[model samples]
Target: MLISALLVLHVIVAIVIIVAVLLQQGQGANAGAAFGAGSSGTVFGARGAASFLSRLTAVLAAVFMLNSTALAWIAARDVGEPGSLLERIEPVPQLQEELVPEDEEDENERDEDELDLPPPDSH
Candidate 1:
């Protein structure tokens, strides 16, 4: 339960960080300022979004790192092991027997049956 919740949180934080990084303007955005375009029609004007988005990305990254450490610890500890993987699987003696018959007579009989097939009639 705890692991599942942490995993969900980790994914959400990752997505949010990606969005935040994308939303922040790059250095090339300043080219528009040379033409007096300014930072109008933008969500947080020129400089405001940069700081806010960077802070959000930073916090989300910290959360992601902590969650990753927790998940790694859980895997290392091997919790909730009702049984080992090999022990949980049931033996398949019947399948093995069907796949490989024990008697030499069975193989000979099968070969004979295949050879006894009627020849196809040509049109």
Candidate 2:
């Protein structure tokens, strides 16, 4: 439950980061000259917008990292007990006849069967 919540939060943060980055101006965008093109003598100055965007991006990025770490920690946690599919339901005794014996003949038969197949004819 906690892990699921954390995953949802991480997804939300990712979306926020994407939206924030897209709304921000590019590196070469100038906000002073003509149609907000040049950055000669702007009121907000050079690093104002960059500083705000950087801080916002940093906060969201930190949240994303934290949620990722939390999810990983939850996934790596050990459960109460470990048991096989057969062992979980009932305690069945092993059947001696069902066991496969490792023999050289089995290997040779497999190889022969594989080699007998014909190769494909490409047009």
Candidate 3:
């Protein structure tokens, strides 16, 4: 359960990192401002958005790595346990084999049949 929760959180953080990276303007974006693209008077000031997004991306990436490590450790730890998902559940009654009586085929005949060899000649 803990590992599952961590996996979900890891995925969310990874998505946030992707979005954060996409939101940040590239270095070349500033070059457009120099030619009158109007980079001034922005929402997060001149440099605030870049720094904040970069920091957020870094923190989330670290979380993603830590979560991945934790998940790997948990999976490895569970490997030695006796019961996995299938073992925990009881099998349906209908799937079980039923005992049936067979006709009296002697031991020697059973053995010869099992060996699948031809019978010996009676010289």
Candidate 4:
């Protein structure tokens, strides 16, 4: 529940940041000043809208980082359990031995025998 809530908040902040950035004007907007088009002056004051947008972008970015970390931690915790991939299937003790048959004596002897090979010739 906590994770879901945080995810929602993270998405909201991301959308807000994207919209705010798109609405803001670019640096070269002052090129119109040469033609006396001065529309930039009316949209935002002399200092410009950088301060407000920068602060908002910083806040939203911080929240995005924090929520990403939290989600990763939650995912890591959930994978740390010790169990088989098919844990939902019921265990049958009687079938265990049948699943893996015991090795015969001849097979064991073959496994114990070592192979003899000629030594490598050195130049």
Write one digit per residue (lDDT tens) for candidate 1, span 5-24: 98899899889989999997
Question: What is the clash count of model 1?
Answer: 0
TM-score of every model?
0.50, 0.51, 0.51, 0.52
In candidate 4, which residue ranges exceed 4 Å CA deviation? 34-49, 82-123
C-alpha root-mean-square deviation, each candidate: 12.6, 17.2, 12.2, 14.0
Question: How many clashes (backbone N, Cα, C below 3 Å) per candidate?
Answer: 0, 1, 0, 0
Please provide, for model 3 over 53-79, each residue's C-alpha lDDT reduced to its tens digit, 9 standing for 90 to 100. 888988888888988999999988888
lDDT of 3 at 23: 95
Off by over 4 Å in 1: 32-50, 79-123
Query: Among all windows of ten consecutive residues in candidate 3, which has the lowest summed lDDT?
Result: 41-50
Tens digits of lDDT, candidate 4, 1-123: 988898898789889989878876765666666466664454332564457877887888888898889988887788855787798577777754444445534553444246566778998
Candidate 1 vs. truth: CA RMSD? 12.6
Q: Which pairs clash (backbone N, Cα, C closer than 3 Å) in model 2?
A: 33-38
- Residue-level lDDT of model 2, residues 33-52, one tens digit each, is 53565545654445544567
In angstroms, the error of model 3 at 91 is: 22
Residue 110 miss distance in model 1 (angstroms) = 34
